[model samples]
Target: MTLDGFAARPLGFVGPLDLSWRDRSAAVEVVGQRITAEVTAIDLDQGLARLSMAATEDSELWAYLKPLRVGATLSGRVVSIERFGVFVALDDGPDHPVHPGVGFITIPELSWRHVERASDVVQVGQRVSCEFLQFDTWQGEARLSLRAAQPDEVPPQPKRL
Candidate 1:
């Protein structure tokens, strides 16, 4: 329940709570009511709660992704094309909670050579293998590099007359 524009959760010891941002919301249940909750950390600026729902349940995607070290290769389909980057839905993981897919490849990371456009390297519906770089904490997405998955093409040299 939300009180005074803030989300509130019942705490046994504290009773009706009156805490501020970053406070942990207690997980409590009332019989016969939809009282399912996971402890959540509040983000005041985003007006969102970061809940760990996977803790109570098994998440196959999390299970697969959690143990993947950086630089691991993963395959996915290009779900969307953007000027900034491409979003890929990984074949081995579940759909991302927020973005179109769990994987994102930036424009610069898409190719070894100069990329005039994102479409030049990858198109929508294309199957791509990318190297895992890091997790984007803010967006809860995986940062990948398509260029790293391919061999570098040698640049042409000027001919001496």
Candidate 2:
């Protein structure tokens, strides 16, 4: 495609594609043609954009992991632990472009028991299995639940006299 002798790529029917710093580049297949975009800001020093391609590719990290659905079981190494969650680098997929891992286990999902700190349930380098919860649309990461992968601990029963 060309406009005034300049190459023009069609964005297609996909809804509003908002580009942010988080989205450095992306590619979509439209009508059997692969269209790739590299989003940059206008000023180079300030990281602004005048619409130029830094690089182009047919797919991204998320594309490979797309087949995974909610409730699927996954195993990964606990790469990092934050106050909010534990980041897991999935054993079955590529590393996330921006985040530490494709899988994230939130504090509440880290354990069936009450958790005061994320570290109480998981640690860095711990290999854990988790249940896929959902794909976090904003972060483009998979949400997971370690607690769901483990059997609930049975409490002791009182003795009958």
Candidate 3:
């Protein structure tokens, strides 16, 4: 029972041959070592996690992992705060500025009022969750936002009546 040609192919494609091709991609190094990174572009040429970064080491590590999809979830620590927004440290190095536009919920943007400082909401050393919004591989830079990262407001819980 040997068929060298297509006619020899089994019907319904049963058995291991029918199994889907599983891509055994490499894993990201250092599972526990979480370093904060500013959101860069979502898609990279080689891989999903081949993310660009403004910071040195942080972006480098992220690029290696090759996240599975675009607009994935990322986490980082807040290093600095400004009226415009907050800055998070990408594991690579250097702090990435999370502007009010893409980073955090600015005080003004949060409530339509004057926000003297971003620290009022996000303080230094605070860990934040963000989405990989936009990426610029050529520039090695990314733009992120806290407001966009989270969902619609919960309406402040009504002060418990």
Candidate 4:
């Protein structure tokens, strides 16, 4: 919910005050600050507003991630290999805040067979293409599946109840 033309042009948020530009902006040090998100919820009691970085909120980001829907192929270079998952700096898209990459392939999603270490399957700087699983709102990551990317000759069919 963005107002087209509002008098208050928000700039940067200092310790307490949210400084704006058009009406009254700021020229503080905000060079590295470049992450956008929608105000999901406002917890007045906690004095904090929950923000989520959804593609729907960011047009350009959405455009890049739109076609890469569930089961769609997404290729990128492995930027970081962690105990929990493998992070890939996608070929295209905005940078992530916490992760070195936006694409996160968890241990379970890393392979069809059991694995010991995530590094066993992939290594840092290695190139990999995984299938999109889902968009995690809280963590702001694209949960991906490398196992699904390279399926068995005869994939198992889900049994109908």
Report the lDDT tens digits of candidate 3 across residue range 36-93.
3333333444322222122333443335333424466656777667666565654443
Tell me how many clashing residue pairs each candidate has. Answer: 0, 5, 18, 4
Candidate 3 residue 153 C-alpha distance from true site, Å: 1.7
Q: Tell me each candidate's TM-score.
A: 0.59, 0.62, 0.39, 0.58
- Give the candidate number with the greatest lDDT: 1
Sequence-dependent TM-score of model 1: 0.59
- Candidate 2 regions with alpha-carbon error over 4 angstroms: 1-58, 154-161
Clashing pairs in 2: 41-48, 41-49, 42-48, 42-49, 43-48
Q: Pick the candidate with the highest TM-score.
A: 2
Q: lDDT of model 1 at residue 89?
A: 96
- In order of TM-score, best first, we have 2, 1, 4, 3
RMSD of each: 10.3, 10.8, 15.9, 9.6
lDDT of 3 at 17: 20
Off by over 4 Å in 1: 1-64, 154-161
lDDT (Cα, tens digit) per residue for candidate 2, span 26-138:
43324555334443233546433333221222135546555678889999899999988899998867767678887888998988888999988778999999999886644
Ranked by lDDT, the better of candidates 3 and 4 is 4
